[model samples]
Target chain A: MSTTTEAPQVKETTKTVDFKTIIDIKDMDLYYGTYHALKKVNLTIPEKAVTAFIGPSGCGKSTLLRTLNRMNDMIPNTRIEGLVDIAGTDIYSNEVDVETLRKKVGMVFQQANPFPKSIYDNVAYGPRLHGIKNKAQLDEIVEQSLKQAALWNEVKDFLKRSAFSLSGGQQQRLCIARALAVNPEILLMDEATSALDPISTLKIEELTQELKNKYTIVMVTHNMHQAARISDQTVFFLNGEVVEFDQTDKLFSNPSDKRTEDYITGRFG
Target chain B: MNNLFQDANRQQISGRRRNDLIWRILFLGATLFGIVALSALIITIVTDGIARLNPDLFTNYPSRRASASGMKSAIVGSLYMLCLMAPISFVLGVGAAIYLEEYAPKNRFTRLIQLNISTLAGVPSIVYGILGLAIFVRTFGLERSLLSGALTMTLLVLPIIIVASQEAIRAVPRARRDASFALGATKWQTVSRSVLPSAISAIMTGVILALSRAIGETAPLIIIGAATYVAFLPESLFDTFTVMPIQIYNWIARPQEAFQDLAASGIIVLMIMLVIMNVAAIMLRNKYQKNI
Candidate 1:
């Protein structure tokens, strides 16, 4: 089979990859010092599906997304309460090694932050960190990842070129390729395309449709249309609380909560 | 409706413009003051030393007779002291910077340490000479050898390198660390592979500038007893030595008119080294700026 995963293979891969609840969160609360960032949050993310967290600014959407991979641990005085289980294990437990946890759950940021390195090196960085020293193995992983991220065709000739040479959109895809080279089961995107132009945002949206066939994707987006367009499930948050959660079409077409409806239909956010 | 194009307060507008020009001229004068002073100094040194720049000045050791005296030992001493001091200062300075910036908790203790480092960077160089006296010279019993002198120079430059390194490290975008950690890299791995590489050029630029300062330093070495009239080269780190600045100081202090000329020649050599280092720093930054 070609290294580039095609959309037609989604059904076959879903059966093998266990398209079930990969993430289980219950009564989760996050506090940045005295300020409560995420309160009484409960969410379950299934494997091999796209879940988008949508809300206005400072509504705890990004905070909730960060809790999945524990990236919020980087902040000072960030305290967490309640259970966050991923793949049937409490990620915040003392026994869980954060490095290994992050390897399984990759992340891409709002900015397309490629290292000041050659494109090939950026893609191979993750695998190298996990001790993949064999040159041939790294080459194959880099090739497959770049292909999967839809960046291989444009960059195949100059893998030696610095990643900064790529355009903003291409650099974002390179970051995705870097994330995928480690073979992560879950991918977290924190406003990953908010920095891009319309065309670039559309390209990332299309790439997400193709990516959910293999990896569980959790995204935080300010654009409600983006949630409706790409996500299988949509979550709407308001002021550190989850106001509504439903299937994408159902939530956009007919939200159960008045606040969600008001926010979605050009009402006060 | 009010007129859109014409301005009403003609006098006020011209008055504001005049103040702007006045400020600009004042700033220009301030800048020219620095430039004029530096050019005058350089011109004086070049004229005084240009004739003394012969091969013998670099080839022979100091002699009692002004005509025969050369700067071989002092020149070699400064170079060797730099070689010894550079690595020691680099590791200690950058290590402390990394620890403070990356790993240290934002507590009162770390804040105190940060304040101390800032204060040390401003302390008089002669004070560092006193520190070297009590610590390296007397307590350690290292004596006034090349090693002691090097250790003293390291102390003098450590604060500068550390502050510069810290600033460089802080300037590394938070995005770089986020990208690394999201890939499951450990703290050491992320710092070594991503953050350090991004900050390397800036840190190196700072380190080179600090070393240039250390090279021209005289008061500290004098207080630490760097030797004079040294006719022999050091065989090892523990041997007695004298640097160019010390040699030049002794030369200028002498009553003979000829020694002043030799001092000018020594200043020329020292200035050349500093210029080369600063240029190297700029080149290093330009080379790495494009990569990021």
Candidate 2:
């Protein structure tokens, strides 16, 4: 029965796309203890594009995003099965170091989780860990990362002040700057701006648009308008299955699935 | 209908007033009970121990002559004990607390260890005295030396230090831990840089409080065979020793008025030391809390 349903769908999806895949996921199933959180799923995240995962809460979009960086390995009794290839390297292989993977694929969380340190120190932390020790070099990296995150102007005067002293939006930007300082190739954001007010959300979305030019971005957002506005590609997920994967403009305008159309039209999630 | 409503409202107001009176009475009664108990303790200590305060109390060594003897030897002995015990106990206890609180897995063994430490904290000081006697004095053949006494005191107060340090470490939020780890820090790096700094103030406060308790402990020292009379101060860890509590106990046991006055002076000294330690702990805790 499983083979009967999966054969045609595999054939249908393969025929439509030919993109340079940065991350190739195949037959991935995830479980939180005994509860099946993510069903057998396959996806190909394209290189140098803003790919957004839009789904309701508990739809496994964030879980899937974390899998790209092996962040799910930290959780106890969480099991993952299948192949996840990052740049033709199987990230799940025994030889792959999670630390190196995490360094290459940076993550930003739902809330702004800045270190309880000065703003300069927060940005310099990642670089310092990778053995960049010269003070002048660290300072240069901090400035460039902050500027890239669009937070340099506001925090330039108070680089020595505690990161906790910043406003919410500034703190979020500081967190982004911290991730960028490590010079990762890919950035995964899990509801990165959901905790912020609408203005901050808009700012983060604008920053996301600018960031895709340098780093491949895979973002999980509940905001449909956000997915429509910022993402170059959109993958709609439901019940741990991909409802539709298409260009953001095409998915929002002409959703082929009834569920995707209903979701985009503000029906039940 | 309006008249009925007004009558009900009047009843409700009177009922609330009666309830408030009852609550106020209960609260005042509880406050008075606590005050009376505290006053009784202070009065007993002051009346019994104050008269002993005199110049001779710090001048002469312990002797049979109640009028002439002092606790100079015992004071030296206790100072020596503090010098030996404070650093060793603080390091071991705080290290154990940090390991248990931050690194230990939530397994049955860790839970058992936690429960055992808490139970040890509540155990009578005399039991620790007995343990010290068996382990340090008899088994090791240290034989009523200052080292044995200090080791015993260290054991007696260790649980308190561990509990205090754990509370301090726990007060640091998990968000701090996540932030540190997210910056590519290893577990040890995260704990050392972020968690320990935030927890240091609380840990120091706990150590100071534990040391105060250790200084006041008489039962454990006595059980471990602390001398009541020593002619000279202990010059080494192995030298025979006496502490402030032992000296006071010796003086109070005598049936002479002059000796009782000496005991009161010793009590005054001990109380002053305790107050100073407590004030220092509070100041350190506040300073660190503000910095964090």
- Superposed on all Cα atoms, the candidates' RMSDs to the truth, in angstroms, are 3.9, 6.5
All candidates: DockQ: 0.76, 0.33
* Candidate topping DockQ: 1
Clashes of each: 0, 3
In terms of lDDT, the poorest run of 10 residues in model 1 chain B is B1-10
Residues A1-269 of candidate 1: C-alpha lDDT, one tens digit per residue: 34477774786556535658899989999999999988898888878899999988999998888888899999999999999999999999998999999999999999999999999999999999999999999999999999999999999999999999999999999999999999999999999999999999999999998999899999999988898889988999999998888778789999999999999998976
Q: What is the lDDT of residue A204 in candidate 2?
A: 93
| lDDT tens digits by residue: candidate 2, B104-216 | 98789999999999999999999999999999999999999999999999998899999999998998887677656665667777778788888899899989999999999
RMSD, candidate 2, Å: 6.5
A167: Cα error in model 2, Å = 0.9
